[model samples]
Target: MSTGTLYLIPNTLGDGDEAALAYVLPAPVRERAGTLASYIGENAKTTRAFLKRVGTTRPIQEIEIHELNVNTPAGEIDKLLKPLLGGIDTGLVSEAGVPAVADPGALLVRRAHERGIKVVPLVGPSSILLALMASGLNGQSFAFHGYLPVDANERIKKLRELEQTSRKAKQTQIFIETPYRNKSMLDTLLSTCAPSTLVCVAADLTLPTETILSRAVSDWKKKPTPDLHKRPAIFLLLAH
Candidate 1:
């Protein structure tokens, strides 16, 4: 029997407003996802909630939602893919944003390729790209460096290096922080980067509360700090 295709599903940026679902994902993508019987998600509970919004054709309870997160063993990849090998179409759902871009599901995607299973990426919201789009920075060249070091000193050192790289290469450097650490990340960015470097803090993308702030480091210090506390945000910087 032919192996099933692994549908790379994109989850919303945030659950700010349920009414906004209609516009976040295209109708065709949602319709197709609704028909899937199996899914491999970063978090099964959230995946079920997302499918609930899509109004799955079959009862959500009947659908198989398996978890594949940061803690999932690499050796277990093939096991999770057994259903797909049996010709069961499965969706690789991310906790947020597109699957595989900055998500752990990339491993599953690669294994699927080795097994000759088709991989399909559906259109969806990606906070990283969306932030860069509105940041008024160098869109022609950019790089996303997932997360900086958790230690303050290390993160600060990393930020300085990224800014210098952006200055010399004219490339946008992008990264994200846990919701609770958003404010801390912003603080590090403001203090560590050069005064003229362009910094963008895009929060709540695609949600009703979406906010994109892009300005020089000096200018950032002049205005009241945004309430980035506990808010999911994507940070971008470009140096001249």
Candidate 2:
């Protein structure tokens, strides 16, 4: 009987460097990548370098490709996964942060599970968790609504709805936008949310020059952070 495996990688911790990265990823994942590299005619060094902060490794029989919206048919996921379904090792990685946390790795995971493949989530830094940690808001209850609406008017309407929901639920509301749209998103947030509501902006998280600032919307309205171009960020709303 063969066995399959999935390795969940984490985002960078404080910064994207070897020393800071060492503590954020699972040690076992690093070890496992070494082992897999040996079988696949690849160097563990390169593989390790590619996955410096994703996950610790483990033994498995197969590894499926980890991308999204491929032309492959849904039924074919089973066939392609035959090698790993019984007992293969796989890894899920997002561009930044853990897979499925505003990224597109969930489809592959769901398909894998339908076939009885064992899924292992490796411990690592999560941007959402990091944002919540620094938000200075009610962490006990919160909702991550993924990316906000792209259209301006729709986006503001959604933000208003989210604010109302947050107030009633007494939970923090978290959302994000593509890097280029950060400025627009911030503007809409400022215009839409109440003046007294507490807002947290976490930019370039885990990267050099990371900033986690929490203050009233009115304060930010005066002197806003520079346009968040060229940086990844998450925003949180905590009603007082």
Best by lDDT: 1
Worst 10 residues of 1 by lDDT: 14-23
Score each candidate by Cα lDDT. 0.91, 0.69
Stretches of candidate 1 off by over 4 Å are 16-18
In candidate 2, what are the lDDT values of residues 1-240, reduced to their tens digit? Answer: 765676655546334566666656667655655444212112333334455343334433232233343344565545545556556565555545676566555766787777677877767779889899988998999999989889888898899998998888998999988889988888888888999888898998777678888888999888847668857888999875
For candidate 2, give the lDDT of residue 55.
Answer: 37
Candidate 1 C-alpha lDDT tens digits along 160-232 = 8999999999999999898899998999899999999999999988877888999999999999988988888
Give the lDDT of residue 70 in candidate 2: 39
Q: Model 2 segments beyond 4 Å from truth?
A: 11-15, 37-49, 52-66, 69-76
- TM-score for each predicted model, relative to the true structure: 0.97, 0.82
In model 1, what is the error at residue 187, expressed in angstroms?
A: 1.3
Model 1: clashing residue pairs?
none
The true-structure Cα RMSD of candidate 1 reads 1.1
